[model samples]
Target chain A: MDIVIVVADAVRASVGPLGAAYALTAIGLNLHYGYTGLLNFGHVAFLMVGAYGTAVTVDQGGPFWLGILVGVIAAILLGLLFGLPTLRLRVDYLAIVTIAGGEVLRTVIRSGDKDSLTGGVFGITQFATTFFGANPFPEGEYGWGRLAFTERQLWVAVVAWSLVALATILLVLLVRSPWGRVLRSIREDEDAARSLGKNVFAYKLQSLVTGGVIAAFAGMIIAIERQSVHPDTYLPAGTFLAYAVLILGGTASRLGPVLGAVVYWFLFEFTDGFLRGAISAGWIPGASSRRPTSARSE
Target chain B: MPADAVFAAEAVTGSRKPDAILVVNGMHRSFGGLAAVDVGHLEVQRGVITALIGPNGAGKTTLFNLLTGFDRPDGGSSTFDGRPVTGLPPHRIARAGMIRTFQLTKALAKMSVLDNMMLAAPHQRGERIVYAPLRSAWRHQERDVEERAGSLLEKFGLADLRDDYAATLSGGQRKLLEMARVLMAEPKMVLLDEPMAGVNPALVESLLHHVRELRDEGLTVLFVEHDMDVVMGISDWVVCMGEGRVISEGRRRSWPPTKR
Candidate 1:
């Protein structure tokens, strides 16, 4: 293969990892939007918090599991902080608050003042050892030919996909249960659920916390795979990507997010790959530099 | 199983002082310059069907909303089963064993009929935690809940539609489903806002029968209705509201100049 083709092939292999993480994050958005009718535009903030929580903890000498736990807790706390004031408000208010929150969180994490602890513009690194240390697979190339993965990549894929599967199953079971029904009922009509003795606010809070934690888990996986945590990774576009995934997949359907994530990543990769190939072939000149802008627009 | 025996027993227990399942004293609610409700005393008796009837904008639903915590009263004390319930949130008041149905029939449109019933049941203590695995014991509890819900749906002749989404049901069926859902909570009293409104004549008969059945089954029923036939046909006692206050109250036979 040509060098460009070889590089594209390498990137294609990484889509699985990226897709797995997105699937998890999308599932969280699915819970908030599809099931509960919550307009949470700050979902990316949960991802950022998760990634930073894990990176910061691991960088500070915490165990990988501890970092994961801290990430989950931070996500939950962030969810509460965001949900408490806004979830009680109308949908429009929540949407505004959440979108603004995502931006604010990104700015704070990237702030020049917090450079020492957060590594400022340089971002955090050397934090993947904790996660990679737990990998049980022996180091070697895995997968068939063009779709091959190194042992490290395969391990990350396994762990990330496993988390997605577990989250999906748990969500399925929960939505089917009495508790899940309450969430759906609240989504259908909050006053009705309240009349039936369901604390609407509490259920909304729980849904936010659960979904946020899931998003955080996805963020942690992404941070681990990249071996870094940067504020730019948690852009508003990430939230929109999650929303797109949620919509593409039937909302309130258990496998919807995962299916959406897969389709989204596949289409995204195909488009990028085709575009890059066209640029290299001179079919689309100056497309390489513009690709990042188009990708960001998406 | 004989309805007469229960009725006779209730009668022989002379003067059968109406057990106040809920007591609203000095309740007041105002909207801007208009006083919506200003009742001095209103007692919802246990185990009897009571009707709160009034013309449009008479504040019948508003009172229900206030007493049930669906809306806050400007001022008043509400006592439910000897517990001071003033100003409690709707869910808390509901969990205290008093559930209500909406005038518009707020059924869970997206959920299956059975799931709607199950959701009405209070959440178990252990279900709140994330790490708590589904144990066999909880499964058994869930099965019992499902069985109970199924039986209630069957009682209301809705068993065949158990798996169907509630939104797919007709207006009458939605009303029936709302009633059935409330039963899942085993609430002491159910405040139904216009259960007979918008129901077909055939379904109205069934709805009235079920309301009577609910009373016979020892659940207090308070409903708001404009249908005089329904109000007189089923209500043990009728309270009429006009301009936001109880204008008149009497036995069904004695309510007169009854032309709204």
Candidate 2:
């Protein structure tokens, strides 16, 4: 196997739409954790909500764009549903509710009773054909052999990266403005910001809703990339990865989250490839790639 | 105190006339079983620096919170500009031209010093989310705000540290920054809760000077301070509170002069 091809594949996935999805998700996390000092551990729940919202709506005969719109609205509603009562309490309570909320959402979508709508354990597909058909890229292979994706993947990647860029610009402009400053001040101390005439509770709710909606877009982008939605797709591990991206890209830094995602995915995928390569070469005796010791191979 | 009582008796029903900008009647607040504030009647005359002197737990801060809408009173009526302002939110009270500073100096630590000052500018169009993206709408107003903030910073001798994070400032500097920031609202009345709590001696003198300048500029100032010299030096009148009640209310000189 050509090691360069493996590395190239890692790089492509790192900077492509796959990476940008995490970047967008991390942007919302940055706003929640970085700027507002909120502890929303169930951030991936919005992405789950977004994915199912789009997939189910499309399955029900709605247009792909409408599905995406529904996904966004769903995320916004979820934010409010969690925020309206929780935001008034201490920050840690939001953390507890959000983490538990993520688990609840994942488990509910996997319920056997909802299999007809959610596709249950098998998940949903055929919902992203409309999304890929509008890719605008001419049919051809891009990148090295085995490392390559169709022009369709290239189109999705382009849109994802662009969306990340747009969101970054929007966030930078917001934080520098007076309204953004109020959010930061709220993070510093709510009572202090309140005494300065800011509506502290209102601002907190807005940040939560804004961040959650952005996380929804992350879900949409990810679903479009995979051409499918699985209940496991929005796992708690993904949130942990997004947080790793958030931490890697220092808190409160405007471009940190996206950069963190890019670097993180590159190293992460590269390490997995390296470990597999090493195992196949007999460098590690006990490592298994799940082939179960073939009878002909002795 | 006796003269004030006689004057108060002659003016109206158990209280003086309403010439003051801030007038409170029967304002009371309690925390659990403890009565925190129970001011029967009080007036802060406009265009003067009135010092509210009280020991710890004497209800000065509680009164300030109630008047500024940071806290609600269980029973009372108070007015600013002849408008009832007993139960409005803090922001509404701030918009109505009564700005305040915290006792511990609530400087936004992570923000630049200039940002802390600029954030307090009243009626900022950029603060509205819908109009924030439209740069042209608030650009000129932002410039004006920055200019005002710059001038205030300069007046407080913090012009050089405008770009530095507020967290880097000394305790005394933070106090000055808070004072300068409150001016951004152009409030008609300013309530200062221990404005010089941790300030150095030299800065205290300067702080008193700024307080005088505030009165000179015709803004009503009601400050809660334990510093007797600073109070007597700058305040036109002194109101003394002890155990949630006004023990004495009089001019700076007549209270047995120089207990120090």
Index of the highest-TM-score prediction: 2
Q: CA lDDT of A110 in candidate 1?
A: 84
- Report lDDT per candidate: 0.81, 0.85
lDDT of 2 by residue, A91-119 (tens): 88998888888899899888845458888
DockQ per model, Cα: 0.51, 0.65
Best by lDDT: 2
Give one digit per residue, the lDDT tens place, for model 2 in B1-260.
22242233222122353367888999999999999999888877777677889899999999999998888999998999778899988888888888888899899999999999998898899888777767888899999999999999999999999999999999999999999999877899999999888799989999888988988788888999988888878877778888998776766656643231
TM-score of each: 0.90, 0.91
Which residue pairs show backbone clashes in model 1?
A: none
Provide the lowest-lDDT 10-residue window in model 1 chain A.
Answer: A289-298
| Residue ranges of candidate 2 with Cα displaced over 4 Å | A1-6, A112-116, A289-298, B1-14, B256-260
